[model samples]
Target chain A: MTQARTLYDRLWDDHLVVERPDEPALVYIDLHLVHEVTSPQAFEGLRRRGLLVRRPNRTVATIDHAIPTHDRSLPIADRVAAGQIEQLKRNCTDFGVPLHGPGSGRQGIVHVIGPELGLTQPGMTVVCGDSHTATHGAFGALAFGIGTSEVEMVLATQCLLQRRSKNQRVEVTGRLRDGVTAKDLILALIARIGVDGGAGTVLEYTGSAVRALDMEARMTVCNMSIEAGARAGMIAPDDTTFQYLHGRPFAPSGRAWDEALERWRTLVTDDGASFDRSVEIDGDAIEPMITFGTNPAQAIAIGGRVPSPTDVPAADREALTKALAYMGIEPARPILGHPVQTVFIGSCTNGRLSDLRAAASVLRGRKVHPGVRTLVVPGSEDVGRAAEAEGLADIFRTAGAEWRAPGCSMCIAMNGDEVRPGETAVSTSNRNFEGRQGRGSRTLLASPLTAAAAAVTGAVADPRTFA
Target chain B: MTPFIAFESVYARLLRSHIDTDQIIPARFLKTTSREGLGRHAFADWRYEEGGQLRPDFPLHHPSARGATVLLAGENFGCGSSREHAPWALLEMGFRAVIAPSFGDIFRQNALKNGLLPIAVDAGVHAALADAPPDATVGVDLGVIRLPDGQRAFYPIDPFWKACLAGGIDEIEYVLRQAEAIADFEQGAR
Candidate 1:
């Protein structure tokens, strides 16, 4: 008989290539997702070493970070950006790696396209160079972000030397109330635990609330796990995960589907399995949340007030003071009704069909505030086409928001889509770090619904008010 | 990769927590393919003012902290983004190690692979290091740090990584050595 093991334990055991005492375990990688920005240098490393990508068939490449999201038909205007994208294209062609470039209908954010194309599945190990690669963990895979060095290592050997991380279970009990979203729940969790709460741990999001979330919402919750400083965040695969992956292009088919489901069903943690650390939150008490400072931990409910720096610990007062000063927020004032200059609705975090639909629902019979500049960028071309088919794009355009192309637009500001300095943006993307949206840009991290409400109200407002 | 060497250097202290990769190397400067010449742009936003001049108030620019190769940072240093450029910029700027209470997991890995040591110290030891004068020399050897006061602390690192650092060996060759085992794993995985 074996001791009760966690989902992470199972995944680790299954992927172990070489495990020895006094050394990092070498684990096999199932899927490797590459993008232009991080892969150029990694490929250069490979070229310099005279090495070949060990498993080109298991690797997929795409352009999202440095490619222009708008008017893909036109040539990329920035020389450096063009060079990076072209470099990835040439590398993919030369290395026999599959690429979903501009013309490929599969082209989109790497994290987005992975799940949509079903390359990300249960009982697998996924690695990418972007931190948001943890977004795929929603499918019960042991996925994580690696640096360029590890990226080159993976390309060269299809394996990574890793130390096993401690297990931390983040359990959200009960059901989330109406208007409270996955994004809001994650924000509230980060606020409660602080930024480094999950350091050196792999978080298993469990309990009734996490299980109740749909596939897209689950991805949203896992997407921001890095913001909480977790090595990775995962949810056990169940019916929702199976249903989402069932018929996608890369998913198992026919007889293979039955076999895959059998293995996925066993991916859950066994009863009485214990974690090294645990945090429990009441989901029903959560409200639509927003960030008041640069880090995600400095968040508040939509109706809550910006906390006073003096009220925090002496050690934390300085950070709070600097954050409040940078964000231009008055302590103890309600975060609501603060004016926003831009509203961006896209990223690996929330740029999905359901997220766009939720935002479109808010703009169906309403117009955006005249003072607000709203950019509605989908996560990928597949998401864009689906939203267009469902008339969500029309609602956004009719409400005065720009329905742009599919890519990681203002979320990264790498493709010339940016919030100007000194401007405030209400964004659904994860991370509100200084200059994340743009230099000197003040980003208020929120849900799609909250971002949509701000788009129409031209200020920070509760999505429940519109509801 | 450069071999990790034991050396003594004055440590520069920046106690701001959650010092993210975005601050270390902003996204705007990430367009380049080459990893060279990034030291000039390291901490570009904080190190430089609006007119392209170095900010006088920035701690790294202080007279006593100049040319320091070791950085005493705050908790969760290198917290955001998995960009290897963060460690690259730090190395280029002559920083051989970062001492902190904690580090973002990915950044710690990136630093070690690039020969930039990430040393995790307890809050008490970290506080003492922080209070040390910028000009006080600190010693760092294999898996151990010697503070300005001569108090020693041993840090934890994987034996394999420590060996690689000591030998200045590229890990790719190490991984390549196990290609047959990797292929065997793939065969069984299928």
Candidate 2:
């Protein structure tokens, strides 16, 4: 008899292209997503080698990281950023790859476009030059980030030499309480595990709370898998996965849809399958969470205080001190009500339509704090239209937030939009790394609802108060 | 391109953990596709003051640490974005090997592809090496770390990766080496 297998194992095994004697097997890719920041060199390498993109139809390109998110009519102001965006368009055109450029109504963050267009599906193996490619694993796909070198290899051959990572399952039980969003849940997980906890491990988030989340919420969780050092994060395909993919543009149709559904039905983990490691958490124990330091791992519940240097291990003291110094905050003090000069709600992590709705719900009647400049950049053009259709943009605009075009605006500050130096921002993007938003800019990462609450109060306020 | 069989060097102990790729090679220096000019930019933010003077406190700037080819980084070195530029910049800076308690996966792969060795030693070995006499020369092999006193500790590595370093071959060569086997698998699957 055969041993039981996990959904990851099933997907990985199915995609195996060729097993190598000593290295990991080279696996075939089903969908390859490309973007501006990381693909320029990969494409240049291909051109250097006189190689052609092996599977152009399977690949999709978009302008996100380097493209200006405001006033698309005008040329990009920064010369270097403009060149990166232009290089991508030239590469995609030369390589016969479809591009979602400015005015395509499809241009957006790579992670957002893949799923919103229904290109990401259960059992598919996806690779993107960007690390947040793990976001697609929310649909039970075997997705992970690759460096630019690997992107070149994939573009040239449509396959990757892989060493399979050990599977580790994280189970969240019970239900999340009001005001506790997916962002809070993932922040708490990273804090518990530390930054290197998931190193070399493929994290599978399971149990009732994961099942309870919608597609966007699941993406929010999987999106941060890299933050915990996990190679990838996934959830098994189920009713939510099927319903979400049912009518999307790239989803299978008619007879093909029935066949696809039948196949997806069998993509669950077998009852007796074993994972290398397992973690169980009480979901109700989580609260609206925020990161106070340079790394996403240095986080706490909103009601909690910054961990004193003494509270950490000896190896962490210097880092904690540097983090607190950089953040310009005192240790051992309550994190609540810290002043924020800016508020941003967008990124591959939390820029979906659902995230906007959550923020709009809080800003519907309230005005933004007098001292704060607010930005509500959508993840994709599609999400932008959806928000406008629902009058979410009206709420943001009426509340004095700048509702702008879709892209990774202000998330990594690659575009012209940036949080000025010394300004503190409560942003919904992943990665609170030092200087990530802008040089010397302090960023406190929180859920959109928390960010919205902070926007109105000009401090880190609990969303529950608004509730 | 001979195998990276063994080497001995006084390790530069830069023990800060989670030194992400962005720090190793910041985005500002990433515009150029070629890896030639990245050496001077490696750890630009940390190794130099904003006004372009070297910070005497940084280990790389220490009087005796110059020309040290091996790097002793903290746990989770090369985390964050999947940039090959991190390893490219390090290699350009004359580092042939990096030793750590852990490493980010993509960075390790990138290092190997460029003939740079990423050694993941156990915590005991890492701590001992971190505390190794400031000018002590430590030996590094495929699966072993040799102390100055001729004692050795073992660390696990894939035989294939060992052979890749040993043979000085890239992934393309590895694939070509298995061409016949791959063809057989393809035909059978069809």
Leading candidate by TM-score = 1
* All candidates: CA RMSD (Å): 1.1, 2.2
**Residue A317 accuracy (lDDT) in model 2:** 97
Docking class of 1: high
Candidate 1: regions farther than 4 A off: none
CA-lDDT, candidates in order: 0.92, 0.87
Instruction: Compare the candidates by lDDT and give the number of the best one.
Output: 1
Q: What lDDT would candidate 1 get against the real structure? A: 0.92
Evaluated against the true structure, the overall lDDT of model 2 is 0.87
For candidate 1, write residues A188-285 as lDDT tens digits. Answer: 99999989998889999998999999999999999999999999999999999999998999999999999999988999899989899999999899
- Interface RMSD of the predictions, in order shown? 0.8, 2.3
